[model samples]
Target: MTRSLPALMLGAALVGLSAPAALAQSAPMEMHAMTAAPALNLSAYGEVKVAPDMATITFGVMTEAPTAQAAMADNARRMQEVFAALGRAGIADRDIQTSGLNLSPQYDYVQNEPPKLRGYQASNRVTVNIMDLTKVGTTADAVVSAGVNQIDGIAFGLKDPKAAEDQARVLAVRALQDKARLYAQALGVELGAVRTLNEGGGYQPPQPMPMYAARMQMAESDSTPVAAGQLAVRIDITGTYDLGR
Candidate 1:
């Protein structure tokens, strides 16, 4: 429907059309538009120490001869001696496992050297699981006395890692709590419910210092000095907490 314009002052009409002065008015806060609020995030890690109850020693024998048959025969002889020694040391047949065996021709590599096919080398490796920590030194010595030329590796580890891991987890949680308390106090606010929690995969069992240098000279020693240090477990956790005003 069409209607006639109302009779009004031209100046007043122009003033209405013009924008009004803000009169020192303040802009409403754009809290959502300006920036996001800060979030509380904290993380803590804890570790626990435990003595190792088990040890794994990988020892082997290497023999070389002009012929593969001869090398095999010698390997068998030495391995038998080692087996006897293990038995004497109170190791069960089940605890002793053969991990590797190899026979290969040795080669000499020199510049312009058509690799001289040296004597054939054969090796037999065994894994010894020792339940008693005290026997580690004696067993190593015995294996050497039995003609085991190669001590591949020795590691002291835990028989069960579950309980130790749980204990470390408790320590980690307490550490996170302490951090949250400190943060909340510094911020002058109360730490509220946890919004997020994440745990890093827990600790690995500690291992012995490697004794990789060949000990062929000690094949007939009274006893070798061995040290079994404490095993350590670690825990890590990250947490997010809501803050109360």
Candidate 2:
């Protein structure tokens, strides 16, 4: 069937009106999809130094004899004397630990012949934690006098590092915050809450201080001297923040 001219014109007009309404309804949804959260990333580090409160002293007694038994016996006697002296100097038992012990046979090599047994060497080493920094020199002198043939070295350290580490972490966080604010300001964006944070750092133990050779004898007129320097702790942090326009 053929439609009349009036009905045909009315249908065309209704189709034109609905097209604009559909487009208007979809515009806001497209704008909402275009808007997204912006973000900024930053990192920072911090450090702190403090004097060491404790010292570690390592020394050993060595003895040689014709037989392993005799060498061990002599080493044990000298080590006992050293232990007694340490106790007299106010070193606690828990602070003293045996670090090494060995008994080896000395060898004599001859040309075109099998190696001959020369003698036996015995050694006993101990590591002592000296709580009193003032007594470090005195302790070294006393141990040397008590027949300690080997002085490995001395290391200065802290008894507790948690406080220092905590302080460093706080400093790192503050630095990160300041840096983030600077970046946001320069970029012309408002800084929002932290979106992500990560912390990283470590404690580096103090190295051993230089000391004389094991066989060097101490001068009777002067006491042994030691210097315990300061120790440093550090921390680092990485953070991400939301940037608002």
Candidate 3:
């Protein structure tokens, strides 16, 4: 049997009323789910100072002669002597690297006259890693005496920077946590667990220090003096911490 028109109308009205009630009941729950907890975002850095255990020195032999072949031959011979000196100074073949070798024509420029060819100049540059700090000065002296006329630069560094980087990472995390705590205390809130963490910076090698070739040419009785200063390893970190209470 079919329901009466009035009963059907009543049922439809009841259904409409229940739909709004259900939506109203669930609205607060949906809003609560969508709301995120308060977060404190912070960034911090850490640094560690350490003495360098090794050094890299770039030096070369420059030769000038009337002919290109003569200039190159002279440069090669002097480079050989420099290599021998390095070997005697306890530098391994693996530590020695040829950075550059160039031969160029020299010219004399005169006013109201075209450039005149003077001679050919050749240069052979080598970069050597000295593991022993004590031998740095002696090695320089030996190479200079053997045939190194150009001293490009010197850079000091660690044999292994992993330990230093890890130490800096620890310090960075501690600093971040401290900052979060301080912020939380200031806001009169409790610090919660770390929501996210990101790491950025790491160990960066220092730039090579300039050294004059004349200064490297000390007296025969005295070796070249080299000072390996301290190096700073740094770490940067950013974190997101939850706030509670």
Candidate 4:
């Protein structure tokens, strides 16, 4: 049956109005379906302790004289001797690096008086990497005996950190998983697959040990007693896990 023109127009208007009303009624259900699922977020860390295999010692020679030229010359001569001593101690040239060199004028300070020029001082510093742990003590002594008057500090570390870091990473993941499981059980929810995983914190160097000129007390035949204590390698991880009934 053919509809009249006015009836057709009226029907088209009614259909347009009903379409929007139908969409409005379904919007809430669509939004509910799009809601995010329940999830648990957690962070954990792990550590592994192992003995250090290598050491680096930063030591220097300080020389003072009436003139800057004289002070620098004296410093250079003493530093040469120190280098030779290190060579004797089995430290290769590749391991030795000059860290710093400076020349400065010294001042004699007196109460209520202008500063007076005392002399000029020159200093040279070198950092040496010792691969052999047993030679650390004797190496320190050798440098001191050969003209290293000032010992700055000593640091111990691993030659290669990959293995240790990998071990730490495994431990960290296990810890994170265990924590997620525990939380899920306590909440009476089943633990689901990990939604996201993140990793952080690896291989931090140990703090330098404090060393002083006074501590290098030389015995007739004994080397300085250096204790290579254990070092801790750590790893941290964060993970998000899905939670379900």
Error of 4 at 18 (Å): 8.6
**How much does candidate 3 score in TM-score?**
0.84
User: What TM-score does each of the candidates earn?
Assistant: 0.76, 0.77, 0.84, 0.87
Minimal lDDT window, size 10, model 2: 208-217
Residue 129 alpha-carbon offset, candidate 3, angstroms: 0.4
Q: After TM-score superposition, what is the CA distance of residue 198 in candidate 2 from its true location, in Å?
A: 2.7
Off by over 4 Å in 3: 1-35
Name the regions of candidate 4 deviating beyond 4 angstroms.
1-27
**Relative to the unseen true structure, what is the Cα RMSD of model 3?**
4.1
Instruction: Give the winner by TM-score.
Output: 4
Q: What local lDDT score does residue 33 receive in model 2, on the 0 to 100 scale?
A: 92
The digit string of per-residue lDDT tens for model 4 on 1-245 reads 36588898999999999999999999999999999999999999989998999999998999999999999999999998999999999999999999999999999999999999999999999999999999998999999999998888899999999899999999999999999999999999999999999999999777678786666886758888888989999999999999995
Per-residue C-alpha lDDT of model 2 across residues 1-245, encoded as one tens digit per residue: 26588898999999999999999999999999998788888899878998999999888999999999999999999999999989888899999999999999999999999999999999999999999999898888888788888888889888888898888999899899999999988999899999999988856667666568632456777667677878889998899999997
Q: Which ten residues in a row have the lowest lDDT in candidate 4?
A: 211-220
For residues 1-245, what per-residue lDDT tens digits would candidate 3 score against the true structure?
36598898999999998999999999999999999989999999989999999999998899999999999999999898999989989999999999999999999999999999999999999999999999998998899889888888889999999999999999999999899999999999999999999999887777778887777767888877888989999999999999995
* Candidate 1, 136-166: lDDT as tens digits: 8888888888898888677888888889999
Sorted on lDDT, highest at the top, how do the candidates line up?
4, 3, 2, 1
Q: Which stretches of candidate 2 lie over 4 Å from their true place?
A: 1-38, 214-216
